[model samples]
Target: MAGGRLSWAGLLKWSLSYVDGAGPSGAVSEEERRWLAEAVERHMMVDVVSRMREIALLMSTPPAVLEAQGITHDDIEDLLSELQVHVESIDMANDLHSVGGLVPVIKYLRNSNARIRAKAADVVTTVVQNNPTSQQLVMEASGFEPLLSNFRSDPDLTARIKALGALSSLIRNNKPGVSAFRLANGYTGLRDALNSESARFQRKALSLTHYLLSESHSDCSVFAQLGFPHLMMRLASSDDSGVREAALGGLLELARDTTLGNRSLLAEHDRLRRLLRGRMESIRTMTPEDLDAAREERQLVDSLWITCYHEPSMLRNEGLLVLPGEESFEQPPDVAGRFFEPMRRAAARRAPPVEGSDPGDGTGGGIVLLLGLAPDGRSNSPSH
Candidate 1:
């Protein structure tokens, strides 16, 4: 247990000898868990890793510099706390790099300690954020099942929130990979989070639900079978701004899915349509406060519109329709001024349509004229 660098070979020798002596007795008082964690992690053997993991769990002491002897319970606990953060940061970086060795990281995601569990989830999410390869490994490692199981009963708000966040991150990609079929079971986790008492949990669950509906080409029947639509509706009244935003956003995304769109998702189509129509209708009948709300609503609607229909012509045409008029004296010139230049650029690129050419023939020349056309087919020009 001297301060010499601990190698896997050396660790194996020490571990075997320690096991023979009935578990490193007499308190190698100076052995730090971090150093032990590092050594065991490097060994990568199931036995060594398992033993170190157990030791880590046992030694939950605060930080103290370990000598050659062994560490205290408080020292172990402190080291573990920092280890969780360090592992999370490293796992996230590995995710960024598409490294394939994240299974151990996922193993600790549901640790008994809520903070540790949360960090584990964060690390899993980091792996999924960009590294599809590692994501697959994690899924095959049965990470999601235990995670979902924890969701059913875990009382820690932070742990539940992290679990939800991790699920969201994983379902963001639905392509063929190790994760391709993992989402088949994702509905369980999503439903649990959606039902949680925490607003943050609901928001994260909804966000993940939205992603699953949109990204994973899975059948919407799973959600429908789980009564997800009802769950979403219930959350629409969340008092938290983030929760409300996510609930609405999730529903919006769900509504865009052709599979769900035709089903019950938009069964409240009339309500949603009326909601949208009312925004326009009430603009003419709005009070000052209503006008301000309408303006902000319009900006949100415009941003959503631009995001969905990103083509320049579509943007220019829609931009003009949504831009506030002088009659709407509350219009913000600064906002319109920012929007005008983009509209003009889009209009300039738009070519006037050729009489009979295929629109797909790279001849989007009608863009400018399309931009100029009034919503009512009347000219944008001043009356003579």
Candidate 2:
């Protein structure tokens, strides 16, 4: 096993034994554990790279050649699905893009076959998500127009969902893509999705709207003009916790907008004020178990209420009463701290070494690491 191919069945047996305190000579050494870890990683990487190569070849092949080979559209859809599975890795996404795979994938967004279009959207979504280079490439390829068209007019709900997801991935943290999306009237489709009867569609739409507003002030303004704030306020009280959370998140983003117009619009919504006050009162009366179960919603609503309080003129305009020195909201007592405090203290029992002393070697002088932290927490240095 050490020098040859590793089988999943063999690995599973070894892992079970290791967990059950059964190893070679009845004990597992650190060397054995490290070797197992490395073997598992190598095995996984080999499988992934092999599959990625196949998909890339298929993507780059000419359509006529594929036809001559008896590869139908269904086969291509299956390959695209496989590509989607692998594209969660940044290297796979980059490889796909480098092999001229992206253009055909974007063209498939308008494929007559619904399954192919959905799979293509899934592939695009997986490729562009959290990947800035892929996002920029998709935007430069004019990918937004097809995606928006499908998002607006696709008869298949599943395809529409995938298209909306792909659009979200394209616009996330990409300003140029957002501008293109807005110019193409993408917001109208999003608004329709938000108002749809399907909670799943509404949730995805709200999540995308949250990302849009969070990235671009112009998007927030456009959404506000489309009465997104009112829609969010209505959804904030939704029976579906997920929907409520998404709506509140969007509302919170809108409230935090630095532009006075966005803030003022939220402030002037009478329904929003009433919703905030009503949720606050309900939360104040809830039992501990209920609060614990609804902790995320409670936190979001609390944050929204506090935001309202911070905006003074907005509150005053609503004729909401407030007392001086009453702006602070008390946090719930940290009940879990009583159980964890001793563990934390035990972990911190060792005193800190002198500032100039190296903990690694007991050498004098601290190390000055010149590392620039990027948004993703990766080092920004060229060597990185």
Candidate 3:
């Protein structure tokens, strides 16, 4: 309609304007507006389709020919970045599926170029974040396998993180997708991710784990069976507040699930008690400038302490449930420490050594590695 190329927003504005003669129409009706919007999306969608085709052509072509044309994976990565922005819109996300762009995107999960793989996964992540429609579309397209593969074993940690993020989005609130994850043995992937040397990875895994556990108590058995209880405990002590918050969220769900043989799981467990107490002690000194995660961690750790101890925590007694500036505790953790001895003895006697762990190592020093923090605090893990 103008000298420059048309955009969806511009077309819609003109077509639905109070007064218009751009197309021999005067202020189109709402019904016509809907038609016009779809038309614009399909028309502008060529930009996306052309890029997707370019990526496919470039990727499938011989390396020698690609070199001859000076095409590179960086070009593919840039195209993916553009597509990601487009798919952030619900219509474009669905349009992407309508045109079969998902297949190539999924295929790229195994691309030789790590950056392209990560970017592809990132694009998938954006596509499925809150779009259940796209989530189902991806599941139907068999997008899970490649995403899970990258998340479970991709050499590049960024690819793994992006893949994990995409997986998290793919399954969230989608039962069939979650069942697919179950069939795919997703928990093991989660366990490995939990043990990663990256805080970003740990936070993602923890968040997804929390969602899974909270969705159904039956999963608690599966997770606990995977020895995730220990990992969750370790993660509760992460230096990163985001990781700690997510870990505490998972821990809270597990504690609330009384059906997973609830009593013996974590109740009156000394190490847990001590960890919760340590978190409690810090809640007192938090300032208003502290992050929301810290405040939520305080609430979760408080609830967890109460659930595990079956009594009001010091923060609870002071009504510190809200956060800093609120007065908050009543339980003497020292008294709680007394329970640790007996439980430790009982646990040591009955609990099997965690798989792949040293039999004699009673101290759970192998804390969950978070985004940039390694087990030994020496990771070059990429930040989110």
Candidate 4:
């Protein structure tokens, strides 16, 4: 081996010569061939490492330094685009956070360039998803307002979808973040997303709406006024199964609201009843795999049924039995049943008694009296 710099071209030439019988009238010795192969491998590794080092240095450069270099927004957009490729690496994500890479990334969310804004929103979503610390930092950097603004008014559908996605990740399981979002009229943005022509945006918006509604009764109350329940009921029947599932999830959360008014409002909607009955019929006919896939939808349909019918027996059937102490003080019993019982009794009275039975036997034909009962094991109705 020569003590000279080894170029890839030179290695190739040597290897080709060795194969062409330039050495020893046919072929190089085994030792010589091994040495050439090792040399080529080592040179390739060195070149790769050198290129990697350049990339590392470039990524580690601060945003301020890039700005000082007169880097255009397009250049920053390219850099962020590259950064997004490695965002799945936890180490790279944390490094980006620690080095303040996210600050400029967040700022780019408001950039005049729509592509830049869209890419920035995607980067923010990837960084903050399931990462609470990054979420808080984004919030501190005023990241949320831009996302909500984009969601509300961005002309580009893709950018608005990205913004909605980021907002969903930003507030997931973050209490204060959700509160801040609610304070920013975030529900209105979400409502618009729900109404978007893009089904992806509607699906993501429904998921976030479910989370926010589950977090507080006040959010449920506000969203209810925005017709969130009606939107969900419509979406629950979406042609896209994912959209239907997300919408059903939102309806389930709304159904769980302890507020009597909210429950009543949902239960009283004729559309909701039709939706529930249709879904229940479909669930009954589903195959086992389909049943598993639709387990959440089935649960929600059942919940809505119980809510609408005020059937504690149905709740018990579903293992959602409410214990005595666990019941809300403000929740009244099934007063709808009580309110309709008199009508039922009046109708029963108009019908003739069974031919072989006495009317005084406390029975109208085979119909049993639904009279209120006393704790002493006696009916409150007048004795026969």
Cα lDDT tens digits for candidate 3, 130-175: 8989898898888998998898889999999999999999999999
Query: Per-residue lDDT of 1-384 in model 2, one digit per residue for the tens?
Result: 213334654785677587557864546677776777777777776666666666767766878898899999989998898778777889778777676678888888887889999999999999999999888888888788888888998999989998998988888788788778778888888889988887888899999888887777667777888989888888888878789889999999998886757766776778888988776666667666665565667667767766766744333343222223334234668898887787677656756767876677735332334457989998866573
Best by TM-score: 3
- The global Cα lDDT (0 to 1) of model 3 is 0.79
lDDT of 1 by residue, 1-384 (tens): 112224555765676566457575644333553466566666553343343344444433222434234754344345444434433443434432233334545555655567666666766666566656655666667777656655556778787777766665664553543253354465676787787787777877777676666664354666766877667655655556566556656555555556545334454445544443443454456565555544544443334333333333232344433445424423457876686788787777776677887666646454423336588888776466
Clashes of 2: 0
Q: Any runs in candidate 2 off by more than 4 Å, and if so which?
A: 1-50, 57-74, 281-287, 309-384
For every candidate structure, what is the RMSD over all alpha carbons to the true structure, in angstroms?
16.2, 11.7, 19.2, 18.8
Evaluated at residue 94, the lDDT of candidate 4 is: 54
Candidate 4's error at 366, in angstroms?
A: 51
- Candidate 4, residues 343-376, lDDT tens digits: the string is 7877767767768778767654544546688789
Span of ten consecutive residues with least summed lDDT in model 3: 362-371
What's each prediction's TM-score?
0.50, 0.66, 0.71, 0.61
On the 0 to 100 scale, the lDDT of residue 308 in model 4 is: 63
